[model samples]
Target: MDIATGAGLLAGLTVVVTIILMGGDLKAFYDTHALIVIGGGCLASTLIRFPFVAIVHGLPLGLKFAFTMRSTTSRDLVDELARLAEVARKQGPVGLEKVDTDDAFLAKGIRYVADGYDMDFIRDNLERDRDNFLMHLDEGQKIYRAIGDCAPAFGMIGTLIGMVQMFSNMSDPSKLGPFMAVALLATLYGALVANLFCLPIADKLHVKLADEETNRTLIIDGILMIRDSKSPTLVREMLLAYLPEKHRHEEGEPVPA
Candidate 1:
């Protein structure tokens, strides 16, 4: 699980709820008309911008990525590649078939090498797979961003409608409170929905997209190095370049225990 995503979401919701409860009755904040305005507008706007498939598939995919952690880290991939390099040197490409990896992209590359595929073919397929995966992440990011963008505009619309209604009722003191409630409530709903949910998830997905691209690229390089029959130490050093500077080890360092 992604602790940061989960923790951040939970903390935001907790603070919101606590503030609401401390202020007054939470039920007073609820208005069916306000909800319909914000919810309906966001949904309609999103549909206008994206296909239904994006809502059906993209939303769940985005949520899944937000809540889950990547199975393999770049450092782990370097270590795994180094080990596989030794196997390739001693037992040849066939030895790679016995290896296991947590990363699906790395596994696919390993399969290609073990099957005696050409290096160009391996690189092309890996790059295609990486691009396709990144494209989906991009779609998810855009969908949520659209929703976040639409919400506030719709809230303002609803508030304006409420104000118009409130003004029309100026002669009658009785109906002002209800109309004003709709106005205030719509804004509240929009702010909460955009800030607490859609926008944050969109930003998180953007971060995920970048990390995935980096990791997949790193895996591709490591896989090709293994295919070339590079020495284990050399592969280790080369793959270490893909990691952040702080994570890279120095030359002639003691071997990991």
Candidate 2:
């Protein structure tokens, strides 16, 4: 589990709840009409913007990725690739068939090499896979972003509706509070949902995408090197370039000619 995503969400919610409780009469903040206008309107707008299937399938999957701990790190990927390079160097590309890995991308690349595929074939297929995966991630991000964008607009719509109702019902002072509550609560809900949940989830998904891309790229390069029968040391050096300078120094020596 990703502690940062989980903890940040918990902290934000705790603060919000604390503030609401401090204000007394927390039930006063509950406005069902406001919720319907803002929540329903946001969902309707999102549905219009994206494919129904994408929203239905991608959103939950995106959230799961954001909250889940990624098992593979760049360093772990480099190490695994370096080991594969050694195996290929000693026993040739056919040796890779015995290698088992949980990483699908790595496994696919190894399979291609073990099957005697050329570099062009490997690069083309792997790049296409990378692009498709990234495209899906991008769609997921867009979904959350659309919700963030629509929530505020819907909230304002609710506020306007409430204000209009308040003016029309001015003859009765007792009904004014409900209308005003709808107006204010709608805006509050919109801000909270957009900032605390939608946008944050979108941002986290972006981070996850970046990390995945980096790891995939590293694997691609390593696979190419392995296919070429490059020395494991050289493969290590090449992959080290993907890391930060501090990490690179710790993980590898200078690349030799």
Candidate 3:
């Protein structure tokens, strides 16, 4: 699991709960009408903006990515690719067939080399796949951002409705408190949902997308090097450039030919 995402969510909730408890009358915050207006309207507006399929599928997937730990990192990909390059150099492209890999992208690239695909064919296909995946991630991000933007507007609408009701019922002093609660609580719920959930998740998804793209690009480079029969040491050196300077120096020196 992603500790940062989990921790951030826990911390935010803790703070919100603490403030509510300290203020007393915690039950006052709950308004069924406010929830229906803000939450329901936000969902309706978001569905209008994005495909229903994307909203239904993308949200859970995006949240899973944000909350779950990634199976691999960029450094792991670099090291694995370097090893594959070494195997290819020693035993040729056919050797890669015996190499077991959990990563589908890496496996596909190796298969292409073993199948004698030209450089252009390999590069074009891989780039297209990467672009398509990135486009989907972009759509997911936009969906979350749209929810964040629409939520506050719905909250304001709820507030206006509450005000209208409150004014119309001004003759009855008993109704004023409930109407005011609806107006204020709707705004609170909207702000909380947007800032603590939607916006943050959208930002996290963007980070995940960038990280995935970087790893995929690294794998592509490694596969191309293996296809060209580059030495393992050279492959290691080339891929190492993708890391920070500190990490670059930490890698073992290239093996002597």
Candidate 4:
């Protein structure tokens, strides 16, 4: 799980709830008309922008990407690759068959090496696989962003509709509070849905996309280095370049706590 996403979302909801309870009960914020306008409008508009298939598949995929952490990091990958370098050095390509990796991409690279595929052949296939996976992540990011953009606009439209109804019914002062609350609630819901949910997830996915690209690229280079029988120390040195200067530990130095 991604702790930040879970924690951040929990904190945001807590704050919203606290504020709501400070003034009134949850029922005060409930408005069927406002719900229809914001929820229905946003959904309908998003459908116009994206295909049903893309929305159906991409929305859940985007959420999964947002809430889940990457299985491996560049530092971990470097360490694993360095270990594999040692194994390949002693037992040659066949040694990699005994290794197990949670990462599917890295596992495929190991399989290729163990099967004695040529360096060029390995690089070409891995790069193709990396590019294809990246395309889906990119699509998910765009879909979330599109929903975020649609939400606030629909919120304002709902507010406008409420205000028009509120004004027309100035003859009934008792209805003003309910009418006004419903109107403003649309804006609140829109803001919350967009800011608390859609936009943040979209940004997280964007960050994940870049991180994935970097890690996959690092793995490809690492695999190629191993295939060429590079020394474990030398493989570690080259792959360390993929990490930030802060994360780049000296050979004998312990990794930062």
Number of the predicted model whose lDDT against the real structure is largest: 4
The whole-model lDDT of each prediction reads 0.88, 0.90, 0.85, 0.91
TM-score of 2: 0.90
Give lDDT for model 4: 0.91
Q: Per-residue lDDT tens digits of candidate 4, residues 10-29?
A: 99999999999999899988
Model 2 global lDDT (CA atoms, 0 to 1):
0.90
Cα error, residue 67 of model 4, in Å, equals 1.3
Model 4 CA lDDT for position 251: 62
Model 3 residue runs over 4 Å out of place are 251-257
Minimal lDDT window, size 10, model 1: 248-257
- Per-residue lDDT over 1-257 for candidate 3, one digit per residue giving the tens place of the 0 to 100 score: 89999999999999999998998867868999999998799888987888888877677777787797667777787788888888888888888889988788878998999888999999999989888777777777888888888888888888999899999999999999999988888888889889999999899999998888888888889888888888888888999878766556545865334
* Per-prediction CA RMSD (Å): 3.0, 2.7, 3.3, 2.6
- Summarize candidate 2's per-residue lDDT along 106-167 as a digit string, tens digits: 89999999999999999999999998888788788889988988898888999999999999
User: What TM-score fits each model?
Assistant: 0.91, 0.90, 0.89, 0.90
Between prediction 3 and prediction 4, the one with superior lDDT is: 4
lDDT of 3 at 49: 88
Clashing pairs for model 4 are: none
